[model samples]
Every structure is written in structure tokens, then in C-alpha cells.
Target: MADKIPQKCPECGGSFTAKKLTTTCPHCGTKTELGIDGNARYAYVAPKPNQGKTFTATDLLNEFSAKHVSGPGMPDLMGVNKILKTVSINDVCPESGMTPLHWAIVNRNRAVFSLCLARGADASKRGTGEYEIAPIELAHREGLTDFVDRLVSHGASADDDMLRPIKEQRQVAAAATRERAAVVKETIARLTKEGKRAWYQEQVKHFEEILGIKSSVARGRGIRAFEKVPVKSLAEKNLGMEEWLIKLHDLAFEGGATLFCEKGLTVSSKIRLLLAPTKSVLDVVAVSNLLSPDEPGCERVDIGRQLEKLYVELPYRILECGRDGVLGDIRAMPDDLEGLAKRLLDICPHYGQTLQAGNGKPWEKVDDVTAVKNDLTESRGFFLTWD
Candidate 1:
């Protein structure tokens, strides 16, 4: 005996496992299981891969009646031909505010326009009133003479005097562009001149600070030295006082030292508990401190010792000046001051306080009290005479 094949119930498209199946679908309770000699029914079959690819002209006609517009390309043309078989051209795109006649006329497609007119498209079907200006106006502006001719032949108004002087309007636009360019050029020239003047003034000030001289002489010297010094040389390393202060007042700005004095000290008789630094004392301390460094094998040991010795000896000279209630005025020894300021800027850059070029029209970054005081006095344009 052979094993039996399972029967598929037609109602639910499901297989029945038993060899002798009942007449009803077990899942749906429909009479799908037929007896052996009952009425014959065909089995379900899947379609071929390209079975639904093509459309008939009647299909295109129905679709166009339903949808007002069709896209471009081979597939769209196939569908368009299908709709054309069943419907007239005028009835196809009525809802779109354009008939096939209007589309063919506007696009200057003479063959398409002929086909549409042969298919009973009305020549005088005007589009909806939503357009501010009609389609013919657009064709005129774009200089599409072919489309203009087609519209005129289709009974569109050719004598409409709605044209603007487009050439004159374009010339005016070109003139406006030239004016804007000139304004930009003027602004750029103005900025350049302003920058040059500001830089010149700053250089003049820098020279006076170094040479302890009048601005007029220093200004001329600064201009000459500015040309001589290479920008790379200035940036390579920190400046030393001898290289800075030894120049003539007409020389470019360089470096120097600060000569401290007793009057510059914060401590008094009542506040003697606090350390009061006099020029001579400070010089001795600087030399001694450099000679005895906390770190061993430090770089530039020999040069460091020499600088320390110079720092110690110079304070004594300033002490004499301090006796007259004046710390050697910074302006009097511009080169020395520049070197001192540079050195101080190198190490205790903030002089034990936070470094800030404070907010204002003119900016300054001096954390050391004495340096800050001198800067203020110099800025005031008065001889900083100590009482």
C-alpha cells in the first residue's frame, strides 16, 4: 500500500494532513474539500515576472481621467497611450487646469499638439484663474519665439501690450552692483590708513620709553631701526639690558632694568616687621640669590652668576637717588627700564600677582606694584617727582 498525499482545503488554502479529507475546511468551516467525483476546480497559479508590465490604451485613458497629470519617460508614455485609447484628450487633464493641447502648445511640441487636437482637445479651453499672468506672458519674457508662434496660432492673444522694458531694468541692476563694489573699496582703504596711523603712534611711544628722550627725535630713530631689525631676531630669544639700553634715543625700542629705592618700599617705622627692599639691599640679595641656586646643574650657570652680580651692584646707585626721595625715575633711564621690564616679564611675569592687561580703552599688564606705579606716572605726562 502507498502512502496518501495530503489534500489542500480551497477556502483557507491550507493542507489537511489526513489521507481521506472531509468536505469542510477545518479552519474556516467552508465547503472547500470536494469529493473525488465532484465538480472540477482549477488550482491557484502565480503570475509570470513581466506579466503586468504593459498597459492597454484603454488603461491609460481611465487612469488619466482619474489622475490629471502623467510623468515623463518610457513607462509614463506606455500608460499615457493606454489612457488615450479610451478617453478624449480634452477630458483627460481637465482637473489639472491644463489640457494636453495647453501642455503641447506651451512646450512648443508641435507633434504632440497635433495629436491632442486630432483627439478632440478644445483649442479655447482657458486655464483656471489662479495664474496671476497667463502662460503666454512667461513665453514672451523667456524669448521662446517658437512657443509664442504656437500660442498665437492656437488663438491666444498676440497683440497684448503687457511687455516691460527688461533691457533698461537690467542696466539699472548692473549700475547698482558697481556702486556697491565702490563702497566696499572705499571702506577697505579707510581701514588700511587707520591701521597705519595707529601702528606709527605706538612705535613712537616705544622709542621714548627706551631712550628717555623726546618723541620727535625718537620717532625718527625708531623708523630707521624698525627697518634694520629682523622680525625673526626679535622673536628668537628674550632681550638683555645691555643690548637694549645701550642704543641711542633715535634707536628702536629694546630692553632694560628697574632700579629699586627705599622710597619704593612698602614698609615704614611702624611696619618694620614687614620686609622693606631698598635699591642697594635688593641688588645684594639678587646677586647672592643667583649665586646660591636651590637647583643644581642649571643651564647658563656662568651667565646667570654674572647677571646676578650686575643686579646687586646697580641697586647701590639707585639708593643714593632714593635718599633724595626719588627712586631713579624710569623715564630718565628708558633703556635701563626697558631691560628691567623685560627681565621681570620673563620670570615673575605677573610679579607674584595674576597677569592681566586690564579691560579699558588702553590696556596694561603689570602685576608688580612698582612697575604698575611707574606705568601710571608715565601715562599721566607729568615728571614723576617724589616729595
Candidate 2:
């Protein structure tokens, strides 16, 4: 009988060391002796740990409320989540058909709501009695904005009569419901960006078709504006060769650029077409300086030998354009200056770079074409060899 006796204390309602007929409550220093008719009442009771509840949810509501009476962040069963996982998680109040979800919504306890959700609590379950309200509707009425979003995102229907008016309410509406214009602006912005991408794609395709080669460098994004090819015919019958020599000398003297040239050529403009496939200044310059004029090399190299070899080596024989891809206007008599300049730039990338750069500013030294153009404009004859 003594071994089976409970050891709970009365004074502080704490456990005590039981011995003989006397025991002291360690918590409050209270002493008690067993009465003739032994009863454990509040003096001694064996703790039944982990005992499954024999009562209903309605009867447990008061205890539940007491446990969670503390404010937000400290949930009722927060520390006992694992224990709750072992219980009848779907229990509801008999009076209102309100489950733990409803209670969580009423308290706006997001932690508890998430826990209940994870444990198979139904958020969309309707309450009983005069009014049927879901957890989302309850939160909406309570003006719990975050709860409303969490509920909606987790499968709560905004179309429900109970949740719709709450969805329209300014204080509780979700981000999409509240700022409707943001959706439109976001869509418009996306479409606008896509449209620009498509336009640029088409432009790239057209550019490739015109030159029969692809260009990675975008039109407006390039370092320098695509300029006209400045080619001159160099037949012995004409003084074009002499004029070209004088221009090269002035380029070295005025603009601090040394340019070597091939003696002359009467073949078609296909020589310029060779540069269409390349955009690198180094690559274009290499092809332009094909046959070295130096013993080993000099600051400049002549491309006459390479051009002569290509004229015989390349199978295609039709003249694509005028000398150095100079597109002399067919309709414009013989000396159409405006027509010639306009047609000159509509050429291969290599031809354009070489023709423009050879006159004064070397393509590689075009660090700042805009600044160079400005300098040319300001100093005129001193910075530029020829127009």
C-alpha cells in the first residue's frame, strides 16, 4: 500500500518525497501526514505522462485556450508539435463545428495555422450554426492580411461568397486583388521587351541577308557608326594611283597613321567582299595587309600580292562592284559624287573598315570615333588627310 501511494504535494501542487506517513513538499516547504482514510486528492498523485485524452474537443477547448493565452509567436501546442501529431488532429468543437483551423484563424496564429495545415487540418471546412464561415473568411473579417494570402495561396477559394467580399475589402485584399494595375503594367512591360527582342532579331536577319554573312556586333551598339567605303580606281591610265599615294602620305603626316598600299588593280570589287564575313579590326587589317612589303615586316604591309593571287585563285569571276567595292551608281552619269558616297558604305564589313580607316584614322586606333570626328572638325586640315 505504501509503495503504491501517490507522492504529489498540496501546498505548491508539486511532487514530494514520500516516506512513512510524513512527506515534505520541496517547492513550498509544506509538510503533510497521511490521514487514517488515505486519499491522494492534491497531496499525492501518480503522474500519467503521455496519457491519451478520453475527453472530446469541446471539453478540451478551455485547457487549449489557457495554454495559448500568451500573445503571438508563442503558440498553444508549439512546443508539443510532435505530441500533437500523435493525437486526433481533425477534432472539432461540437457547438460550432469549428476545428483548430478556425481557432488559429481567430487568433491569427500563423504558426499554429501552418502546423494545423501540415497535420491535415481542413482550412475550407465550413462552420455550423446560424452562419457557415471558413477559416479564410474568418481571417478576412478579422483583417488578417497575411493570413488571407496564406489561405488563398494554400487552396482557399476567393470566389466563395464568404471570402469574396473579404477579397474586395481594401484592408484584407491580396496584392493581386488590391493593386490590379500592377498586373497590367507587368504584362505590358514583358510584351514590350519581347517586341524589342523580336525587332532586333529581324534586323539581324536582314543584315545577314544583305552581306551574306552574320554580324555579332549590333548596329546601334557598335563603337563607330558604319561609314562609307573610300575606294579609288588605280589603273595606270588614270591618276587614281597617284591620288591614293598622296592621300596615304598625308594620313601618315597629318593624323599620325602610317598606311601601306598595293600598287594597283583593275579586277572586280570581289576583293572587298572578302572582308564582309569579318568584323575584328585585327582580322580586317590582316587581310588588308596580306602580302608583306617589308623584308620581314614593317609598320605597314601591301596587299597587292594577295589580291592578285585571289583574282586567279577564287573561282567566282563576276565583278560584284566597282574598284574596292565602290558601288558606282549605274544611272548617275560618270561623276556622281553624292551617288558614289551613298553607294560606297553599302558594302562588306571588311571593305567598309579598310576604305574608311585607310584615309586617315586606322580602324584599330578608333578608340573614340566621335572624339576623333570632333577633333577632325575642330582642327580640319591638321587632324585629317582628306575628306
Candidate 3:
């Protein structure tokens, strides 16, 4: 017969006899153990490591929360892996129905979230209750574009519904930028016309800063009038070219000063003629200086020679306008030509017609012609010469 020892239940403090190394308390179902000695006292028995133990979703959440709070960067990855072994990565907490991924997002813990993703957490799984949305949706709602991108790379659906908000936001921002640019132009024009030279210079610097354009002032001989270069008769001319010449003449009467000219089809001469009244020559010098020997247009040994081959070409390119010595009316044009073509057509439909009737291909077919047309229409001025 087995020896029976008198013992007390460690959990409930109930008297009992321990007939085996491990015995259960009949009173409270608590397990107790006794030594081989007949006089050995009963003690609470801890189950074997991981024996009959189930790691629930709640346990995983608590572990992650504790680690997230205690650590600086990420939760203890080993601890997370241990719990993940027993608990499904997609398991939802009983109370919140939020998976570990959802919890990571809630805590804004990207490290843990990425770990969960790497461990096969379902990014497409929608949680219950307040977070009844997929991980990507939550990421998007939180304005985590990188997170959304990652989720997409990991196979999360980038449906139109999920991306519409970002597209809409970008459109709104672009519209605001355009509006703000217009306001800046108007203020600069007003300041220039009011003879507020000090304010105008400040505004011009501000405009240059906003547009990411370098500030340059024409520094050569300042001629009060521009010499009219006679061109082919209208019948033999590209009407677009004729219109541009007409616009330059108009700008001359409106406070523009001819700075210099290089009278030829050379790049420097063309840039000079096109930006004649404006102050973008310094821009040319700056661009020429920035060029490297390996660059395409920098093959010419001299900086001045290189400036002639630099990006600006015949007819397509036009002067960039700003407050510094640019015509007051011209200063009202936006620094960039993006979407300006439509605005130009809205303001001056006849200009588009003239570009279409020009000797060259229609503006739409030409790469930069629409941009030039837009600039000319907005400033009611022209500085570019056609080849």
C-alpha cells in the first residue's frame, strides 16, 4: 500500500492526504505535491514548462504592451515570437477583437507592426468593433503612407477606394499651391506698380525662395529701349513668332529695359533675345557654372560657349518671370508653367489659335510650345526669339 502523508492544500488551506508526488485539492482543484518522506509537507506544484498552458490573444497583447512601454525601440522580439508560437498571428483579443497587428498600429509601434507582418500577420484581416478595418486602411487613415505602401508590397489591396483620399488631398494641395502662387504674383505686381521698391525686393526674394528659383539681376549695359529686329513679312512668318515679337514690343512700353543682345542663332544670343527685358541672364551664368565636364552641353570648354548649348532651345523655351526687373505685368505670372496652358487658354483663347496657325507644328504637338504660350499669355509679354 502506498504511504499516505497528512498535508494541507497550499491554495485553499484545506487538510488532505498526499498519496502521490502530485495530488489535487478536492476542495478547490489546486494541485499540490509531497516529498517521499512520510512527514514531508505539501506544497503548491507549478505545472511543467509550457505544459497545458495556452497563450491567448490577451496574453500576447499584455506581453507586447509591457515590452513596448519598457523598451526604447521595439518590444522583446523573443517574447513576441514565443507567444506567437502558441497564439495565431491573426488571433483577435476577446475584449477588443483587435489582432496584434491592429494593436501595433494603435500603439503606433511600427517595429512591432513590421515584425507581425513578417511573421505572417494578415494585413487584409479586418478587426471587430472600433477597428473593423484592414491594417492598410488603418494605416492610410493614420496618414501613414509608407505603412500603406509596405502593406501593399506585402499583398494588401490598393483599391481605388483606399487611395482616393490621398489623390484628392494631393489635388487639393496642388490647387492651393497654384492659388498661393497667383497671390504672390499679384502682390509682387502691386508692390512694383506702387513704386514700393523695398517691399518689391523683399517679395521678389520671397517669391524666388517659394519657387526654388535662383535670384539673378541683369548686370550689363541697361538700354532704355529694345531695337526692333525686322523679321519676315507676316505672310512668310510663323504667326506664333510674329505674336511673340508684338508682345516684346508691348513689354518695352511697359517699364522693360533691354539689357543686352547677341544677335545670332547661338544659344547665348537666343537666351539674351528671349529674356532680353527680364533678368534671367544670371540664371544662365549660374546654370553654365553648375555644369560638369562630363555633362552633354558642357563639351564646350568656355562657360559662355556652354551657356549657348544649355537646355533652352529655339521657340519652345521662354523666360521665367519674377519681380526682379521683370515687367510689372509679367511679374504676375506664376514661376512654373505646370497646368498654365489650360489657364492660358481660359484667359486668351485667341493666343492658342495663333499658335495653331503658326508655320511650325501646332503648340499641342510641340513639347514645350504650350508652356511658352502659357507664359506669354499670362505675362502679356514675350522675350524668346524664334529660329
Candidate 4:
């Protein structure tokens, strides 16, 4: 081969001596391959290999969307983190017209969602379906306040659309509920309805002795309850009972707990409960005793543990304050409390949790579940002079 010439790299305008057929610019890392004319071949950027095949931008983007929804780690494993800049942030889905960012938002993948937005993912990009949906609206519909904050920070408008699918979803849900209720009412004779109404009142009596609440659940539409007797209602009729109700609601808000209502067996009412966050602490003696009071199918002392590990990670990361205490916020950690049950569990997983059968049996699972619940009521006090 002729003596390799020392010259400025055409790619980066940097100096380097060309030796092998391919040599990279020392300063910029630009690979230059020897052409047929023995000159250098300059490509815009190094081609990425995808499973030993030529990687196209579309293939890269689609793959990213796939892993982004599958959860964290896969995207970084696929080297999507390094090529984020190269992939088109606003690459649209052929079917939904949603950008990769949209899928990230829909899946609550804040890491990839933030990366896409920072790299110029179009916030204004909306799907072309009948909904013409935007990510901000989707976040709002998901009832994810933190997600709304993030999208708003990224310049997404929060204008509520009248025709959004969420509203349609609500209407469909109400209609379905009404249809189902009508069939149930039609099937059951008038005598049965009256019988159920009486039975419901009796159940409420047992429920009150358990939860210690004056109950009425206000669904934002309005509060409705049977005047004679009520199930677990957060009526705030009694001063302190409302506070406990609020705290229970916050359990769902903070931890990955779910709140659900089932139609009362006899009456047209609903029974509401916050599913235990993790480790099925509800299985504890006191808690389960409270929940199962006179309720059929609820086996006492049998706690159901959560299937998935509920990890409470910090939010927005940039701004990490989550408190409101109104509508859906914990106004304040209860004034006279030893500690938050969740805080204790977080500090020591075995503290407020129920143990599994023969597993981790060697490890201590303290049975102080009710003690923690009591600590919630007992306000922490300060002491003074030495006696």
C-alpha cells in the first residue's frame, strides 16, 4: 500500500493519519472507509447494527415503543438510550398516529417520556382517531395528577375537550351500570327488593361496629346514602371520623392500592373498600376482623397478599412534593401519630406485614398490625421537666 498520508479528516476537519481501509477521525470519532479510488468514504453517522441486520430508523423507533411499554431496562438494554438523539422523537404510529412519546405516556413510562420530550417530541402531536387525543388529555383521563404536571411542564396545553373519549367512557359506564341494575331489579320481585333493603340496614350496623365511621361516599356527583343506616361512609358528620376516612383514601392514592365498590347484595347501595397495598396486611387479625364483620365469603384472618411488588418511587424527580389533603391529597400526616404505617413498612418490610406460609418463616414478621393502627390515633406528645 502507498505510504498513508497524514491529512485533515474530511468528516470532522480534524487531522489524522489514514492507515487501515477504515480509520476514525481521532477528535470526532467519525469512521472513514477507503473508497474504490483509495480516498476516504464519509457517512453522516456510523450505521447501527440491529441483530446483524441493517437498522432502519422506523425499526428502531417501533422497537423502542415495544420495550418502553414492556417496562424499564429493556430500552437501555437495546442501546435505545444512546441512539435517542438519532431516532425521530415524533415518529408516528401508522395505525394510531401516536408518537413513541404517546405510547410512553399511555404506559406511564416517565423515563422514556421525558427523554422523548427533551429530544423534541412534538407535544402538539395528536392521534388521528375519532378522539384526536393528546397525551395531556390521556394523562388527565388516567387521573394521574403527576403525569398532568409533567406534560404541562413540557408545554402541553390542558384544555379539556368536550368530545374526549374519557367522557364517553364515563357515559358508557353509567349506562351499563343502569342497564345491569334494571335487569337485576326486574328479575327480583318487589318483595325481594324490600327484603334486601332491610337486610342491607342490618349489614350496615355490623359495618359501623368495625370501621367506626358515620358513612356516605360522595362520588363528586353528590353524596347519597340510606337515611336509616349506612355502610362505610365518609360523611364527615362526625368530626374525627372524616379524618380516618381521608387517611384510608390516601392509602390508595400513595401506595398502589385500589378502591372498588360492589353492589350491596340486597339494596341498591355499594360496599367500598381500599384493597391492601402490599403483603396483604388486611390479613392481620384486627384488620381482617374489621373487614369481614358479618360479611359472607370474607374468611377471618385470611389475608390476601398483593401479587406485584408495589414500589413507591419518587415523582417528576425534578419536583418531588405530593400533598394536597383535599379531593385526593394528604393534607398533613396525622398530627398525633407515632408514624405512618406505610413509612414503617417502607423502613422495615417485615414490620407491618403478614408472613407467608413457611416462606421467610425464619425471618421475623411482627404481628403488631393493630398496634400500628392504634399509633395512627395516638398523637405524638412532647415531654418537659424531669420528675
Candidate 5:
């Protein structure tokens, strides 16, 4: 009995009935075999082990194109491997004039691309027609720096024309970094001028990170240089001290000091005021002798004297000093203490004056100008007193 089955001829595209799975197309007289779908349409049969079957370049091209469609899902990589085994990796498709590597690029099939490269695909080869570009140029156009680098490493010609765009991109990025660094520098300067020490320090850190350089202005220690004492804690010790400290806190906030405690208390038990811009500490007395009358080593002055010192004197000498004032420029004293002492005297030339460099340090009489200079140079801080 004849095993008749409907089939289409692969070469002539004619409909016919075949007597067997592997049979000749009666209409075209071409040797045909059943495809996987049981249709004896394809003229070629699957290759047997250890036997090479001849396939036209067009045949290999059509097979690769059909299997490597764009979009998600595993591409038929095994099919491509099989086709490449018979044809050269550089063989061009007659329809698209693109080699196997070019098709892998267009399809964005990384697996196929890697496979082609591993199989000695020429990185310098240019495709014809619409994709008439060398492999390195294509990778560069796609913004694949890794691919371009890899291609160059694999003997692709690194001509100036091929590398110009990458150079231009780097230049643009460098210019942008410089512009941002300039803006940060300006911000840091403005913050310093406004007496905003906490905010200023933050910007200084950011500025250093951007420019990769440590700033000289940032050499002074930060707010941590002052002891942190809460205004409420002081109030607990002396209820009457709270109101006066609150007023001072408000002034400090307006001047840009980073306050550690609620109501801006950064003072120690004996009352140390923070001159934020210079990172200097000033020792001040209580608002009145009544405020801390019994505390040892705490000078209790009359209310009028206290007001004059805290409300009027220190603000003018330290906080409100213009950007180029003596204290503003005195983060650390220069080696020439005599000149620094003269600068100090030029600012406040009052009689019976004394200057203390740090907390618990003995006050140096301003009349002995040399001693004052030495104290200023050593401590990097200043606390002025008058009898």
C-alpha cells in the first residue's frame, strides 16, 4: 500500500501527494523530505553524523535571520551554531549584505555576538548596503563603551574619527564638574560671611569632595571645639539664667552658629561663647552675680556690666566683624605674633584690658603686647576682659 501524504515542494512551491516521508516532488522532480511538521517541503534533509552537506550562502543567511528575531525569549542559538559550523562567520547575507556579526548586533543578541567573536569574527569588517559600517563604529554608535573597548582590544583600528565622540563626551562631563565646583565654592564663602558655621562647614566638606583638595579655610576645628550644654539644663541649675541665654541663642542662630542644644546652648558651666567663624571660644560672665553667685571661679558681675559684655561688646568684636576683620582672618595666628597683637590692639584699644586665649588659661594683660601675641598664637582662641 502507498503511504500517500499531502506535501508542498520546497523548490517549485507546487502542491502534491508523496508516496513516502522522504520522496521526490512529482511536480518539480526535486528530491524533497518531510519537515518537522510532516510536510515534505524542504529540499535538504538533516545532516547525518560525520557527513558534510552542501548549503548555499543564501540558505545559511535565511536560516540565521529566521531564528534570530528581536525581543524577549531565548533565541535559537544552537541553530545559529549549527549554521556557523558550515559557513564562515564573516559570510555576508545576500539580501541584507550583513555578516553574521552584523546581524547579531542588529538583533542585539549578545549570545550570538559573543559566539561570533569567540569563533574569530573580524572586528574590522564593514557590512554593505544600509549597515555599511565597521563593527567598532557600530558599537560606538550604540554607546557601548565596553563593546568598543573590547573590539579595540581585539585588533580593531582605533582611528581618531572612530574615537572623537567619546573624547567630546568626556570633555563635556569635565566642564560640568568644574561648573558645579565653582558654585559650591561661592556658596561656602557666602555661608562663612553670614556667620553660618554649621551650614558653612557642610558646604566646605562638599566642596572638598568635588574638587579633591583640602581647603585652608577649613583648617579650623568645627563646632565640636565647644562643649555642648543645653539651655534647659542651665535653666534647671538657675531658672533666672534661662531668659538671658534664650536671647543669646536667638542672636547666635541669626549669626549662623550651629547650636547643639535647644535654645542654642553650647556654653560650658562657666559660660563659654562660641565665635563660630573663627572656631574661637570666648569666656563670658553670667548676666548678673545673682545668676551664679556661689559657683567657684565664676565671676559674678552687676546686671548692667553683664548686659554690656554679652549684648553689645562681644557681638561687635567677634560675631559681626566684617568678612575681612581681624578675628575673621584669625583661624590660627601667624608666626609673627607681634603683628597679630598690633592688629588686635588696633581693633580694641581700651585701657585695663586683658586677653585670655582659652578656657582655664591665665589672662594675658594687653599692656604686655608680646604676651598677648604669644597667647593668641598658641591657643588659636581669644577672650577679652576689662577691669
Candidate 6:
């Protein structure tokens, strides 16, 4: 019987330990002791260690009113206080259909209400009454504005009849919702169209070969412009970099390979299209120093040589972009750019070091193309070494 006996503090009516649980109420300052019948009860005297406390109806009610909120895993007010070792009122007034918040408001126990609020009990759950009334509804029906205000502040929606809608009201609501969606779609479409229009200009050219329109019969500068092959003409004529880039893209697909110079193909407008299936900025450096002033090399070597010149000059620029531990736009660059950079480095004797460094290898000084190419052929006995 002693082992089975529940140990509790009689004063505050909380659970207590065998050693320290034999004590008075810390909260209410009531004395506690065990009677001769070996049951616990509260008394005016200070609680002694051997005596247990017995609780009465008022004591149970006081405990229930004191502990309103569920602690930790408990969901509502009743589950928390009911599990406490001291109070028995939780069993007497166990919630059947109503939430703890509903019970708290219906009882109008402010201490329990405040405790329930502190322990995160939601005030929005409606009571189990006929109307499915929320705590505030009970408060409002019972003339409890303070409790209703408390519920409102704790995220309870003010509109109690919000769930119900008349047929006419629903029709209007649906129409307004659709109107808002339509406006959003229209705004998005308009913005997209405006952005596209701003970025690109559209043009249609007449192709004599495609359409079978004879060049002899063609008229005006427009027709003449359309008649000339883009790469051949651009390589021979003066074009800006941006214009050259556009024409170069048009030509790489149109023609396999073409070489241009500062003299014949104006320097500012020279875009070299490195690949056909993809767009990549392999490298673009116009070396006026390397180009022969008196004589031009054969087309193949000239193109290769121009590419080599770009390889030598562009490494420092790439390094600068990568210096802050980010390649920035280059890191997010298209796959084509990565491929083109690789191929361009592969063919150039001076570019091996650049490729290795780009791939996270330690940096080493790769001498300029003119010296490296000589060393490869002279000492290494390699015909086309990358570095």
C-alpha cells in the first residue's frame, strides 16, 4: 500500500519526489501532511516529510484552474493538467466533445485561460456545440469580450460565418478570383513580349539560291547585301565587332572556315565562329604585331597562327576573371564555351599551361607561342605539342 501510494505536494498540488516531494506548496504557500489514515492532506502547519497529502473537490478544481495548458507533446489544456500527480479534477471534468480552450472559456476561469494560452493551446478550434462555435463565439455568446479579444490576437479568424456562402456570393467570388488570375497572366505575357522586342531585331532576307531569284535580275543594295556570301565578304570588308559576330555566326553554318585580317577585314568587326553546332567564345585577340605587314601566310597557317596569338594573350584575362575564386559568367558559361576553350587550347603549342591551370593545376609560366613552338620542334622532337 505504501509503495502504491502516490506522492504529491499538497500546497500547489503538483507531483513530488519521495525525498523532496514531501513538502508544502511552493506556489500557494499551503502546508501539507499525511493523516493517521496514511492518506495525504493539506493543513495550516508546515508539511512534514513522512505525511502524504489528500486532495478535495475545491483542491481539485483549484489545480484544474491553475494548470490549463498542455506541456510539450500534450495537445490541449486538459491532457496536460490531467496527467499531473496532484490534481483529480481533470478526471471529474474530462472534456468529451469540447476542446480545452472551449472548456476554459465556458468555465470563465482566467488563470486556466492564461495558462492554456501560455502553453500554445490554439484558441481557434470551435467548441463541440450545435453551431460548431469557436472559443470567441462562446465568449461572444456569453458576453466575454476580453477572452474573444485574446482569441483574435492568437490567430482566430474574426469572421465566424466565413465557411458559409450564398450561391450569389460564391458566383461573385469565383468571378473575381478568375479576373485576378487573368490579370496576372496578361501582365506576365506583356512583360515577356516587351523584353524580347527590346533585345532583338527581326529581318527577312531574299536568298537568290534558295528562292531561284537570279542575281542578274536582283535590284537595290538590299538585294546586293543578300547576294554576297557573309563570311567571304565580311572577311574582306570593314565590319564592327558586333556586326562581325552576327555575320560570323551566319557564315560558320553557311561556310566551313574563313580567315580575316585587320587590313582586309576591318579589326573592330571580326567575330570568329569557332564551332557550327554550338556557340563558344574560343578566344578573340587581334595581334597586329604577328600579322605580316608585307606578306600574308597561307590560309590554314594564318588562321592557326591567329588562333595561337589569341591563346597567348587571353590567359591573363581569364586568370583575372577567375582570381576572386569565381569565374563568374564563365563558370555559368554555356557548354559550348567550355568545349571551344578546350579545343582552342588543344591546337596551340603555347596554350597547354593555360588549360592545365584552368583545370586547377598549379600555375607555371608558359613562354609565348614563338619561343614554345621552336622548343617543341627543336628539343622535344614533337611536331604539334600543345605547350
Highest lDDT model number? 3
lDDT values of the candidates?
A: 0.35, 0.39, 0.48, 0.41, 0.47, 0.36
Models sorted by TM-score, best on top: 3, 5, 4, 2, 6, 1
Q: In angstroms, give how far residue 1 of model 6 lies from its true place.
A: 20
RMSD of each: 35.3, 33.7, 29.1, 22.6, 31.9, 30.5
Residue 147 lDDT (model 2): 73
**lDDT tens digits by residue: candidate 1, 256-281:** 22222223222221100001111222
Q: Candidate 3: misplaced stretches above 4 Å?
A: 1-52, 68-73, 164-387
Off by over 4 Å in 2: 1-55, 59-64, 67-73, 76-86, 160-387
Q: Candidate 4: what lDDT?
A: 0.41
Best prediction by TM-score: 3
List where candidate 1 sits over 4 angstroms from the true fold. Answer: 1-81, 92-95, 104-120, 129-138, 141-143, 160-387
* Candidates 2 and 5, the one with greater TM-score: 5
* Residue range 1-387, candidate 4, lDDT tens digits: 567766455445666666676567788875555444333444323336454454334454555543121222124434554455555666565555666666776677666676677777777677666326787777777776556656666777766552344455556656655554443233223322332354434444444454555545322211112233233344345534334444444443354322222222123233333222222222211122123222222222211121012112211000000010001122334543444445434433433322211122211112344434443344321100100
lDDT-sorted candidate list, best first: 3, 5, 4, 2, 6, 1
Write down the TM-score for model 3: 0.30
> Which window of 10 residues has the lowest lDDT sum in candidate 5?
320-329
**Tens digit per residue, CA lDDT, model 6, 256-329:** 22112212222223212211111111211111112222221112223334444544444211110100110101
Tens digit of per-residue lDDT, candidate 3, span 1-387? 387777665346677786676667678875445533322223322212232567778777776644121232235556667777778889998888898888888778776788888888888988899889898988888877657767877889988866776566557656655554443344334323443345434544443443334434433322111223233322134554334544543443234321222232112222223223233333322222122323221221233222233223211222322211112124344444544444334333334434432332212222244645555675455432111
Show pairs that collide, candidate 2: 8-43, 8-44
Q: Estimate each model's TM-score.
A: 0.20, 0.28, 0.30, 0.28, 0.29, 0.23
Kindly indicate the candidate among 1 and 6 with the higher lDDT.
6
Decoy 1 TM-score against native: 0.20
Q: Report the CA-based lDDT of candidate 6 relative to the real structure.
A: 0.36
Better of 3 and 4 by TM-score: 3
- Candidate 1 contains a number of clashing pairs equal to 15
Clashes in model 4: which pairs? 215-233, 216-233, 283-303, 325-329, 325-331, 336-379
Residue clash pairs of candidate 5: 196-256
